[model samples]
Target: MNNLDLIVVGGGITGAGILREAVRNGFRTLLIEQKDFAWGTSSRSSKLVHGGLRYLKEGHFGLTRESVKERERLIREAPGLVEPLEFRLPVYERRKPGRWTMGLGLALYDLISWKWNHRYMPRNEFLQNVPQVDPRGLVGGFSFSDAQVDDARLVMRLIKDAEMNGGKALNYTRVNKLLRNSSGKIEGVVTEDVETGEIKPFHAPCVINATGVWAENLHPSPEKNKHIRPLRGSHLIFPWELIPITTTVSFFNAQDGRALFAIPWEGSVLVGTTDIDHGNSLTDEPRITQGEAEYLINSLNHTFPGLKLSLNQAVSSFAGVRPVVSEGNVSADKESRDHVIWKDKGLVTVTGGKLTTFRVLAYDTLKACLDMLPHCNLDAISEPVFESRRSITLSHTVSETVLRSLWGRYGKETLTLLNESDEQDLETIPGTRTLWAEIKYAAKYEKIRHLDDLLLRRVRIGLLLSKGGKDYVGRIRSLCENVLPWDNERWELELKTYFMLWDSCYSPDAFQNFSR
Candidate 1:
């Protein structure tokens, strides 16, 4: 711990992946996050692990191929986190891309994946599989394979894996400035513990600035802002019954030619993701604009004419800014998803890229620094280790359904989660598949410094539940009362802070009559 070969700035998935890769490559590493891990775009993605079917249209074949390989690898290596999801892309009579065109794209997708599982479904079979789609102009659909994931959980698991491989992680630690040698080459960082007003210095031969949308803050350049554009993507969550569908429904927005999806996840349906340029400060939490919500709702209603969906039906919502590499004066959505890595003043800054290809991005980041860091050994890169315990364990009785969910999420730590729980903890939270044990385990082992860190990120009850988990606030408080060492006054304050964030950042009401 005293001497380090590399230091990672940011606790996001990108930083976590770098730390994991660095440790596996025999480097002594440390990772520091200004907030909690996955507290930014990593936690707020559309939660898909796919080959970017849309990217194929833009001639991003290499990106799509890499993503397909990684998506398949994650489904195999992290079975508990990355899960296969079926997608139905319904093509209407007047749709931009006709049925045949869409079918050809699906074929190419399947070909690149080499799994050959996609199919073109006729009207009858399509309606049978997805009864919710409007039959008005439905001209059949294309079914393809993809994957869904708990983005935040995957990031936390990577951090856990990095720690298991001898990498050090410190949450609630802010890197105020980069440290430099006499020649002004970056060497380390000066960090401040957010919990307390204490400053400390750490030294390392190399430092990585994997701060996503906030990357420019670490090593600012005259053209840094020109290189990276923050594109905001928002999603609205609804009760599964409201928009019941066993498979994801993909369609283009009638008003604009943007892609949108209604995905089934975590016992609920998530309809999301509008990509638009965000001109707001990176420090502020991204809130879904009312316009964005209305746009998604309109897309859903147009696709399922009978549904008559509205903003009121949305249980909650979320927004994240994607760090997209700018591609001239094009639209935000047209910006390249490919990540860029470069060294400036000895600081390796990594920005852009999709969530599904984080591992490749991490390896690329390290490879970018190989010349500058001759002492680092890339040959030592080892295969990921999946089974290992990082938390304490206890005894309990739980159902097989709940057991499998825990195993998929916790991996080797599922035993610890079960041991940490009793019968009461095994009960599922009302309206959610999540159990009370998840909240307890997160509070105990996930380094939850804030209430939202536990409810929103660690367990996602805040985003999945109606009213952002407000109804179960008392129950959750009771469950984590002993685990988190906070006084009654502190608990009240944390509750107030969490609710403010939930109402403003995780619900549609936050955008009612509000402007950016």
Candidate 2:
């Protein structure tokens, strides 16, 4: 690491992808994250490896095609990470798009991804809605193929792959300054470990600035604020038994045409996602607004008359900003999902683009950066070593029916996850598979410091469980007692600090009066 060829300044998907690609290319690389990996938008995504079916409405055919093909690659390259999910959109006369129109759109979507029509997923078709949702007054629905993935886990796996290929990653490390030579060319950066408060200077020939919403913070300009708009999109998680739709439910907001989704996740039902133009940085945690919660409940009620969900029913909720490139619209949801890469001197900044196409974005970024490289046998390199047969996991398990279910989310890594532990490691935590093993693994391997980092990103119990992981503070503290080197007083203080951090998500008055 003394002499580095490249340095990436973010641990999000983009940064992780760049580092992975760079290392595979045999570049001496250093990747540093201010907090934990996927601490920003990468962890806060809708958890879908999708092709942007809704974007097709806006005539974004190219985006859809690219996403579909990239999705195919993900299922192949990372079987344990990317999984196929069937999405069902119930067609009602009240809805604008009729059965035929929706069917035609899906058929075209199938055509775009015809290469793998038989291997991975089925083509879009009509199916009977699950009995949970009232099928009354419902026309035929359109079902299509997409994939679901654990965002944080995928980011971790990418970093793991990069590490396996000789890349240096430092968590709790902050890049305070971007260095440039006298010739006005970007060269390296100034970084510091937040815990040690130690500063260090690192040099790299090429730098990719994939800090998502924090791009402007690294290299700000007069128009940086206008360049990126941070939108706060929120979601509420509930017990899976409550949601009637077994398949991923694709429903539109009756009041507005915005797309909303309800997917099934680890023994719990996933419901969310109300997009608004406002936002807060990654440092400050965000919460779902009352209006947003009410809208979600009403969407469920309207689509499924038998079901009733109150705010109290919401086990937990989360909110994060989407760093979409500004497209003349103040509304974040209206902004284009396309990505933009900018190179000033030797620094390359990539912002925007959907989650499903991250690898492709990385490939494009690496090829472009190498092409722009002064000269280093760039053309001599043949193909990348990204694809490997090392992946090893399947959903088949002898435990409970839930084992198969959990394996789907965990992937080939699930086998390693299970084999790494004995009887003690099998103990599960709150919010689905928030096991003690996972907590330890996050610290030992995945770079976790504070309880917030574990609950929010590593385990996701913080967002999907009530009390924002306050219920599991004892579990974490007990582990800190045995495994982590901390005093009882320190453990108690960590628990308290975590609660206060969780409280920052919502206004004091809002949470105090926020009863169902």
Flag clash pairs in model 1.
80-408, 394-419, 395-419
Regions of candidate 1 where Cα sits further than 4 Å from its true position: 221-226, 371-376, 379-382, 388-394, 397-400, 513-516
What are the lDDT scores of the predictions, listed in order?
A: 0.85, 0.70
Tell me how far the alpha carbon of residue 388 in candidate 1 is from the true structure, in angstroms, after superposition: 8.9
Kindly list the per-residue Cα lDDT of model 2 for residues 83-150, writing each as its tens digit: 68877777776667766777777777788887433221222233344555546656666657688888
After TM-score superposition, the amount by which residue 105's alpha carbon in candidate 1 deviates from its true location, in angstroms, is 0.9
Reference-based TM-score, model 1: 0.95
> Per-residue error at 142 for model 2, in Å?
2.0
Model 2: weakest 10-residue lDDT segment is 116-125
